[model samples]
Target: EFLRNELEDSTPVIIMSTAGNESNVLNAFEMGAGDFVSKPVSPSELLVRVGKLLRQRAN
Candidate 1:
């Protein structure tokens, strides 16, 4: 609901979850998520994803 409500906002959202199912992922993207990451997250990968979103927003 928050994602849908804030769809027009400039700030990006990244969904992190242990339950990384296809349905949930698609739903999140459909609702305007910038990225999604599965749990047992790697610090480097998270940083890279965040950096990518930041760069995209900058453009």
Candidate 2:
């Protein structure tokens, strides 16, 4: 529902989940997610991913 409403491509969506299976990751991408992070995320890694997305969005 959130994705459906936020399809204007302004806010980049990142999916973070414990159930990080292949199908789930694929589903997120198919639903317009900009990135996906699995459970037990490292702060630095998450920051990097977010920064990368933000940089891409800015460009």
Candidate 3:
């Protein structure tokens, strides 16, 4: 799988999906995604999540 192959590269992925469709977010988490955001997404929330993920990566 792409994720497995890229895991060693320390790649981060963000997945977005409707509230009712949680599978995509779950899959992304299973694939080692750094974060997941659900829609209808708010600009402030999106910025916060992205900022958190970036800060995580920096540490």
On TM-score, the candidate that comes out on top is: 1
What local distance difference test score does each model get? 0.88, 0.87, 0.74
Question: How high is the lDDT of residue 55 in model 1?
Answer: 96
Give Cα distance to truth, residue 8, candidate 1, Å: 3.3
Q: What is the descending lDDT order?
A: 1, 2, 3
Question: What's the TM-score of each model vs. the native?
Answer: 0.87, 0.85, 0.71
Candidate 2 vs. true structure, TM-score: 0.85
Whichever of 1 and 2 has more TM-score, that candidate is 1
- Once fitted onto the true fold, the runs of candidate 2 whose alpha carbons sit more than 4 angstroms away are 4-9
Cα distance off (Å), candidate 2, residue 52: 0.3
Model 1 C-alpha RMSD vs. true structure (Å) is 1.7
Please provide, for model 3 over 1-59, each residue's C-alpha lDDT reduced to its tens digit, 9 standing for 90 to 100: 37656556665567777753667667777877778777788999988888888888899
Query: Which should have the higher TM-score, number 2 or number 3?
Result: 2
Clashes in model 2: which pairs?
none
lDDT of 2 at 34: 89
Considering TM-score, where higher is better, how would the candidates rank from best to worst? 1, 2, 3
Query: Between 1 and 3, whose lDDT is larger?
Result: 1
Candidate 1 C-alpha lDDT tens digits along 2-58: 745755575888999988999999988887889999998999999999999999999
